[model samples]
Target: MRHLRSLLFVPGDRPERFAKAAASGADAIILDLEDSVVPARKADARKAVADWLASERDVPAIVRVNPLGSDQIDADIACLRRIAPDAIMLPKAEGAESIATLDSLLGDLDAPIIPIATETPAAIFELGSYRACADRLAGLSWGAEDLPAAIGAATSREEDGRYTAPYELVRSLTLFAAHAAAVPAIDTVFPAIRDESGLAAYVARAARDGFTAMLAIHPAQVAVINAGFTPGAGEIARAQAIIAAFADNPGAGALALDGKMIDRPHLIQAQHVLARAAASLLPSEGGAFSKAFNRSKPHTTSSR
Candidate 1:
């Protein structure tokens, strides 16, 4: 919720990488206990994650716990109760019911929940339910990897590694759902860790599509993701121009700017952009380590 432009995942079984992931400049580190950890290493991963939470964490951390109804869910909840992380990331969350169940289990822990909202076919229909538990939610993200497998598809992507039509629909729905629920829509990870150009294009498209944040599978992707999502000079200038036009033409329903009609909707859009850009300038709170300073490009929130 704190302008999470990039969240990096570290395998829960690999405690050696925990500190490294924290130092990678990501806004938050997700200790993954599900897909990243093998079946046999689950218990060990849980122990390692618990131990890390028990100790001092220099970065904000989220635990990607095992899916609902898994044998490991109980243990995951137990560890969470012992030491609640900043938030809990739920995989394969079908609907509000799973979230409600987690709420009941956690009782008064008060940890925010971020569900992978498009992992299953059932999850596609459950997007609307997020609004009911919006207050307990931190952010909403969707994955293209698991959904294809769950639905028995050959692949979730095209040969170019772009999302296929069906998975694209899932992505769009997740975006709308997150906005509808009044939470940040975090784009899924670009799994091709080595393909920096592909990752850059993907993140750029995500930011253009109104995604407030993105997930990163590797440290190398964090800086690019953060830069892509952060409001750039051109964007801030456009927002300021739009706001100034509206301010000058008080009580006018619409105004002309650069030969284009700027209406109430455009004014609102500009204000939102400025607001998010302003938020990006705030210092990290609660020892949340970030490599945002790595950005070489200048970003100005000062409206002219």
Candidate 2:
């Protein structure tokens, strides 16, 4: 609902790329201090990210800090205290307990969080616990890169780069968790930047499967991700027609459209499509549009 269709990742240590990433048309930019920065460069990366955030205004950025139990987390928290980012991306999120702990730790700062919820074997068992901290989340997302290593697997994908069985399950659970929490479900990174065809197909599949947004490792993939998630003119027109049909006949429970029977279920979907379209037309810097779909009430179909 926040139109986070494309969230690009930039290394925190690469200060020169910060401005470039801001201009890349990505809905949000994540300054990654965890996996992207080596242990020796952690301090420097934190300083660079803090300096950039201090100088820049109107940049929609989030910081990917070290995992909850890592030693570097203290330093990350200190850095965040000095320079408040728009949001925080928590890596290797275990469950509600960790989230609660973080909530206590951040006491006054209390920035919105987006957790990479499926990176460890233990994380697979705690997907349901996210609902407890749903109110503080910007959205929910998962990662395939860390899971394979955690599970001692050679790869998490097939020869074609599609997720294998285990990781596929993780992806689905992440989707349901986000929806259950009434937040957006952002898909994991595609990893292969040069394969434009592969990236496009993967992103289309993600959009069709109810993923609200996607994480991009490179700037080149942002355009493709944005296009894949944004509703096309034909889809917008069809959704509008369905809404109009239902509005025109207030007493009717169902109606015919394009020679097919339209019902309550279809109407509900059309409304969602239109809502997403409207949100897309607005800015994507986590402003007023961020809470457009963060409703606690279910978006159920109306008979009228």
Candidate 3:
């Protein structure tokens, strides 16, 4: 499934934010009805989200409903029926049971799934089985906040502002869960709104750890997230060189390229990088968008 490399989460209760989130340059927008919306405003948020989904728009809009056992599930389900989002973000997903329950509830509905893997105690142990019910599932992600609190952690971060070791374990587990399920491994949001550098560092860490995308809380975070996840010129060149150096080497099983090992796995990795670079190259928009006068950033594929 094609997904948003940068997904911006907008509070469903905020009508003004919902409208602007579409054009905020995120590949998708998550109209959040869970944590972002207060308990009293949930009904109002659901109504607003339902209305927004009916309207035609360029952005791939999704609704993040409350957890399965919540009192708001009925309202969330009703809102989903009306809105018909691209996918449903299931927060606090427990395991196969929870997914099976959702499937049973909405048996005939066609909406896809994107389950957040870290939420509660049960979620951590059941993560290995999370992808068992993946017929309609898109990917997996982890939350640093909920799981830590569920286990009675004081905070989710380290002194250097990185996720604590416990949180890192969850993140890796989420990545493996998606990979095992043959789906995208989405990274969680960077909460520091004003710390662009910190956000970039976090994105870089996630990308290096094999996450394909990230959640964004603000419009300002979108561009950096997109750029950070995308493979650049140096990456593409190195990938190409790796592929070239290994090709037609009949006598050698493993060869050295730039003093680094170039083997079967490395070749596979290189090709994957090139593939992502190719996929991200959208057709240059002109006319109404006016690409002629605007200076576009010279990208990885531009020279190619």
Residues 1-304, candidate 2: write the lDDT tens digits.
Answer: 3567888999999999998888888988999999999999999999999998888454478899999889899999989888877778999988666676666666566567788999999888888888877777788999998999987999989997878999899999999999988888999998888999999999999988999899999999999999999999999999999999999998889999999999989899899888888877776554322333232312211111
Clashes within 3 Å, all models in order: 0, 0, 0
- The whole-model C-alpha lDDT of candidate 1 against the native structure comes to 0.84
Error of 2 at 242 (Å): 0.8
Q: For candidate 2, what is the lDDT?
A: 0.84
lDDT of 2 at 84: 73
**Tens digit of per-residue lDDT, candidate 3, span 1-304:** 2334788899999988876888887877889999989999999999888887787777677689899988998889877776667777889987666777765665455566788878897788877775466555666778888887788999989888887888888888889988887777899989899999999998998889899999999999999998888899999999999888877675677899888777788888899898778756653211211111121211101100
Top TM-score model: 2
lDDT of 1 at 135: 67
What is candidate 3's local distance difference test score? Answer: 0.78
Ranked by TM-score, the better of candidates 2 and 3 is: 2
Please report, in order, the local distance difference test score of every candidate based on alpha carbons. 0.84, 0.84, 0.78
Candidate 2 segments whose C-alpha is farther than 4 A from its true place: 286-304
Which model, 1 or 3, shows the larger TM-score? Answer: 1
Question: Which tens-of-lDDT digit does each residue in 179-260 have in candidate 1?
Answer: 9989889999898889989998999899999899999998999999988988899999999999998888899999999999
